[model samples]
Target: MTQLIDPFARAISYLRVSVTDRCDFRCTYCMSENMTFLPKADLLSLEELDRLCTTFIRMGVQKLRITGGEPLVRKGILTFFEAMSRHLGTGALKELTLTTNGSQLTKFAEPLAALGIKRINVSLDTLDPAKFAQITRWGRLPQVLDGIAAAKAAGLRVKINAVALKGFNEDELFSLTDWCAANDHDLTFIEVMPMGDDMGSATRLDQYWPLKDLRARLAERFALTDLTEQTGGPARYVRLAETGQKIGFITPLTHNFCESCNRVRLTCTGELYMCLGQEDMADLRAPLRANPEDAGLEQAIRAAIARKPKGHDFDYSRQKVAGKIGGQMTRHMSHTGG
Candidate 1:
């Protein structure tokens, strides 16, 4: 028997692939209205995506997540899901999931559920229709809400991915929590990430919705409780006081969870990014485009694994430079499939 090697101290068992760098909505923290993405010719072919998924499965990947500039925006998306489902049928992947803006879920939910899409995480920041429209710009709040309802009806485990943006929607956090409880839905409140080309001068740790404030508000209304260690990664679960509602918090900026990070990202441009905040990447697209043998492909993946960073340190005090902001950041959350 051959002994398996774990190069990055952190055990990477999950892969998040960004199928495209293009999205329908221009999120404030993701892209500007004038932002231009890589040309269509730069994206990986569906065949290339399939080969990468197969190789990762062979290398002990257990969970695969399909993300996008809105993954559903890609043409022939259902066919792509079918291909991934077929490859995952080998029992190598324990779960196949997706993260979407929910704009297209109403039309694609049933077929996706049938294709073994285990769960879905929808990005919805506000519950108010008008406010939601303002945040997503081109998104129709009513349509997204309908899509969420449809996904739940299709028996897909549904979760909301809301970013806690200060001055924008942080005031609605508790209200959103209550709404999720009433709707029997799970909610994850994520901290805003500063990775876009236009973070400008407004992106700072001080602007984040402090966990202390969030926790205080929740504690007043709910009995916030921590989940057992075996339940998986740290989200810090809690139950609403009046209705036993469940809510989660992902405080990556203020309270870094890098030590327990268990995933890697594959970009649509064929680059393997070990950390969302890191600049290092390994290009597997070149080797795979060359139609290399299985061994050659495996070697390329292993090399990518070897480059994974130990962890991301967002704490400016702990960051290498002090008091000074560095040059422009490289990738956006959409490209990294956050």
Candidate 2:
């Protein structure tokens, strides 16, 4: 079997497949509430998704994560999950997981766990109801809490993914850590990345509280130690040196993890992105539509990998390039299926 190693010697094993580029919630950092989404016809069907997943597995992608604008909102998504879980269970893939906003997990959590999805990441930035509503625009804090409960009741390993938005939840850092510890859920604090109009020029850069400083703060409260757990994604895991509570920091802006980046993103419209921050990509829809065969599909995927960028262009400090402020992604996070 031939291996898939990029020019940087990073063996690609993880694939983040966005089933749709539409979400119900409009997070301030992700996109605008009045965002336009792709039409249904532009999305990749389950059949196409199957072929793509198989091709990726053949190329040594052992970890496959299903993403979406919000995957659960899509009709017949469970049926698709069932089919894909069965197929991947028999394939070379090591595990299948998902990342969601936990908005629609109430009815799907137990079913998801039954279908072999044990690990789940739920995006919940703050514990404050008023602030949650403000950040999500119209998101209900109770429904999301219920979703988290459902996920835990279904025997799923739930990791709370919180974005450290400036002026939003930075003050709750210590409290959030305690809350996660008390609830028996692992906590991963992610830095806020620029997506929608840079979330206002006055507040954009200020919102990014680096994980390096977060670690220093945690050290003062609890003994912090590096974790040796194998994570499916690029989160730097740490354990509380005192009680061994698990914590993670995904600092894409401050501490870029591009060198150890072994993953690629595929949008619902069949655009394969080599990196999330950059615009380096190939149109898989063209090849898949023209000839959805093994020969054609594999050739296109291999070509994209060959041309994958060595690293992303993410600068936390926001640099000036020819009088233009840079570092934010050219594409929206919602469209990228994050």
Candidate 3:
């Protein structure tokens, strides 16, 4: 098997693919309320996505994560999941998982679990109904809670991914931690990243709450034991001694976790983003659509992987210099399968 190794000698073993760019909710920090979505015609069909994914798997990708604006919102997405499960059965894929907003899990949990998806990440910022509604403009807290319940009932291990917004969720640190412990779910706190356009960037900068601060706050309330576990993602883990529940911190801004990066993101339109904080990308759709065989597609993927940067340029310290956010990508996080 051919292995994908970048200039930094990091093996690319994980791939996050976005099946669709359309999402049901217009998250404030992610995209605008009246966001412009890509046309369906521009998106690669399910079969095309499958082929692209298979190519990556053949090139030594073991972990496959399906992402989207909300991956479950895409029509006929289960079929894609079903198709990817064959790799798990054959032992070619180590895991098949997804990151969702937890809105559609009630409908997809069973099907996904049957397809060999053992765990998933849910993007939930707050437990307060009013605050949840305010953060996700179109989201209903009750519905998402119901969906999360359904996922748990369906035997899927759910991990809650909360963005550490400065003023938005500061008060919920203990509340959220206690809730996750009570529900028997792992929780991860992420720093708000500087991506997207002016409006979104402005909001992200204002919302930026460094994970260092959040961790310090958590340490005050709970005894956190540092963990050395890695799950093929950026989040570093810690275990709460009191509740015995695991907590993860993804500090992209405060700390750069790019040295051991082993993944690449594929957009719905078949664009491969080597680094999320940089604007550089490679278009694989043209080569993919031009031929049915895997030779050209494999070559294109390798070429893109070869150009992968050592680390993303996501820096918030530049704001101290001239009141400017540095290393901000022009595309929205949703567009890059966040």
User: What would the TM-score be for candidate 1 when compared with the true structure?
Assistant: 0.92
- TM-score of every prediction relative to native: 0.92, 0.95, 0.97
Q: Estimate the TM-score for candidate 3.
A: 0.97
The deviation in Å at residue 304 for candidate 2 is 0.4
RMSD vs true structure, all candidates:
2.7, 1.8, 1.6
Best candidate according to TM-score: 3
Q: Which structure among the candidates has the greatest lDDT?
A: 3
Q: Model 1: per-residue lDDT, tens digit, 1-338?
A: 12224464666778899999888888777767666788989999888888888788777777888998899999887888898897568777788899899999899999999999868889999988878877787788889889998998998988888888777787797788877877888888887766665553445444557666777877876677666443234476766667766677777666767676777889998899877878888888888877767777778778877777776745433332234455335467777788
Candidate 2 regions with alpha-carbon error over 4 angstroms: 319-323
Clashing pairs in 1: 222-241
Off-target runs (Cα >4 Å) in candidate 1 are 1-5, 203-207, 229-234, 316-328
How many steric clashes between backbone atoms does each model show? 1, 1, 0
- Summarize candidate 2's per-residue lDDT along 1-338 as a digit string, tens digits: 57778888888999999998788888888878887888899899977887787788888899889988788887888877887787557868778888899999999999999988888999999989999998998799999999999999999998999988767887888888988888789999888776655543666666777778877888888988887776757688988977668999898877668888899999888899988878788988888878746778788888898887877777756643334667667577877776
User: lDDT of all predictions, in order shown?
Assistant: 0.77, 0.83, 0.90
Q: Judged by lDDT relative to the true structure, which candidate is superior, 1 or 2?
A: 2
Query: Which window of 10 residues has the lowest lDDT sum in candidate 2?
Result: 316-325
